[model samples]
Target: MLTRKQHELVCFINDRLAQTGVSPSFEEMKEALDLKSKSGVHRLISALEERQFIRRLPNRARALEVLRMPERPEKKAPSKVVSPQLRQLPAPANDVIEIPLHGRIAAGVPIEAFEGVSTLAVPAALLGQGDHYALEVAGDSMVEAGILDGDYALVKRQEVARDGEIVVALIDDAEATLKYFRREGAMVRLDPANRAYDPQRYLPAQVRIQGKLSGILRRYH
Candidate 1:
């Protein structure tokens, strides 16, 4: 069986090659997987090669070849009747904005450099004019704010956010999390909507504002 890190690296390389027709560089892989150094990436590559999951070209740089791609789960057929709630979502008439759906954000640990696994389209009016991206919610911390697990949080890319607004906050440059932003004195507090979870506090310099939450989309099956 492949280790968790091995699986992540393989998927990252496969996804990058699929998107760009070129394999990702060691630096790109390192940044995507949040590894400390290129040596860590080399170790994962060696492990993947031993498993016959990937093959490294002997003479070329960044010429690693993917031998076996992982199988994706088959998508379910579309339903005949679309729900009214979904119909109400703003979609541009002539120009539908495509939002890249980055992978899930850790509500607890804070994931950084979200890999663009898919895309979601929303109306131009709803997201306004900005670089927008989507992330899958993973925890119940924001339940009171109506953001539940499995919901997509639409984020407008911005480096700063106002107090009391929902924003994607990167904590300590290691983990990215969704929370309410509030600056208290010299520290920043990330508050959860649910009462069960306590607000996380940190130094002002430790937190980096990624984007403000613009809207949310949910599906009922």
Candidate 2:
């Protein structure tokens, strides 16, 4: 079985490749993983290459390739653990926008938006520095969050989120949920705009903040 850190590294490398059509440099990996030395990242990459999970070309830049998928472990019977929420489906190309669907939303009870069903074209300037994704809101759960349904949200790809800020969160790796972010110690909460759906509370470990909601673009049909 792969170590937790190895698993996280694999996921991060794959996600970056899928988003940017290229693997990150050793320095990028070092910064992303907070490693003190490039050798640390190199070791991890070497391990992944040896396991056939990734391929690396010698002396070439951005030449890593995903070879085989990691094996999923067998679930124990009567497992209470829930799956992690996936942020968005892999885009066909790095240049295309992949918006989260959240799920089937309604005019009444606010449901979280699904991930990666809708998309829009946006100039890189609108995304600011180091930003790469834009998600389309599918429900009004965030109307109170200052976001409306059918709005295109310009997002800055990030791992950490600040309090009282809007964010796209994965609720169990199955749904891409939207809410105002709040955190206290080891706990994180998703504050909804509508009253029908209660705010979601999660351990910091269970929730993954995909990105911060930078700006919104809306259109009426």
Candidate 3:
């Protein structure tokens, strides 16, 4: 059985990995747990490693790996049962939803959509009902909108994107651009936020809507 401290550590690691796609370093772990010394944190980690609940990589920073979580045994009731004032609450809703991370898509042309490139487990509370995918951003066209090259964007797949909304658009059935999507009768326009690049316009028939922008995700080193 894990002690209170060990349980806390496990929960912390799980939350961090879900959000940032990486685990924290020993020093980070120490700080997060508010331990007085790094040695104290190391002791707990060592115990966990020995139990085969987690794995440690030598000579690598932030190298802790989770092998498997220890299971909790069922609690036995006492002969004299007394219900406490505090009742157990239901589990949070987000725990049940699965978010898929679709690989990179070209903003220029009609490309085949690939599923299950990777996945992020998100709380259902944070996402709406729709097909979720990820796009690896490229270029500085939308830099003004705070999206940078190499950033990963979480997109909600949709057949129709709204005007003035940032969208991943395929123009002329060939090239793709991330821009503000707008339509005027028979024409569609892909307007970049940066002035250095000119806006692209296409006949409604020539453009294809691949996906709509839902959210942006960036990782820091």
Candidate 4:
């Protein structure tokens, strides 16, 4: 059973979708339900989703579909029939946005490049704009930056990055390492976050910027 707010939210979303092809925004839902803040709406939506009454469409923030209606035990009147146009089936519940998972990349010394056919499903809200890929961090060289071992680094596909920006640096097109990209006169420098690790320097032609670090994701037990 859904809470009162959850029921109201689902009904509101369903009605909005039926009226228009789009779902209502959080602000609209909050206003409709007399919510104090958007966070409260988020919580109610989460509860409805967990109960399998609704699901979010892939790579969309406001794309919500009502899976099933809540039981209305208090209603004694006949149920209202929904028109065929407004009652279209929703996308599959397992729908998700997946980006390339390029296996593990080094956070310390450079490691040989690897290719894989793996992929990872990520929340669309975590990413924006251009293409992105995921890499499993293999070392603790960026500990001070809160990037730890076993963390998944979300990188935006880019051939260049500004100074002080953390990036995936490909060394001589043979190996890659995650570090801060810097230009020192005619040369390139890969700076590690930990003081224990020395900065790596190489000729500009020898180092290639593969991608820029967009965000980091970690799992806790």
Best by TM-score: 4
Candidate 1 ranges with C-alpha deviation above 4 Å: 1-95
Cα misplacement distance, residue 206 of candidate 1 (Å): 1.3
Give per-residue CA lDDT, model 3, range 1-221, as digits (tens): 34435655766776787788688877888988898888767767765664456887789778777776644322432212111101221233535455666656533333444433777654443345688766666677665455667766656777688786777776566555666788877789887655567777788887777677765555666
**Candidate 3 residue 213 C-alpha distance from true site, Å:** 1.1
On residues 1-221, what C-alpha lDDT tens digit does candidate 4 reach at each position? 34345666888899999999899999999999998999878767765675578999999878999999965423221122111111222222333569988978888898976567489876554556799998888997876555778888888899989986889998999999998788999889998766668999999989888898876666667
Model 4, backbone clash pairs (residues 3+ apart or across chains), number? 0
- Of the candidates shown, which would achieve the greatest lDDT relative to the real structure? 4
Model 1 gets an lDDT of: 0.73
Per-prediction TM-score = 0.56, 0.46, 0.49, 0.57
Alpha-carbon shift of residue 207 in model 1 (angstroms): 0.7
In model 1, pairs of residues that clash are: 110-175, 110-176, 111-176
TM-score for candidate 2: 0.46
State the lDDT of candidate 2 residue by residue for 64-112, as single tens digits. Answer: 8877655443423112111121122122223534443333332223345
Rate residue 56 of model 4 by lDDT: 94
Q: Cα lDDT of model 4 overall?
A: 0.75
Candidate 1 C-alpha lDDT tens digits along 141-191: 775555678878888899998886778998778778998888899889998
lDDT of 3: 0.61
Clashes of each: 3, 18, 9, 0
lDDT of 3 at 98: 53
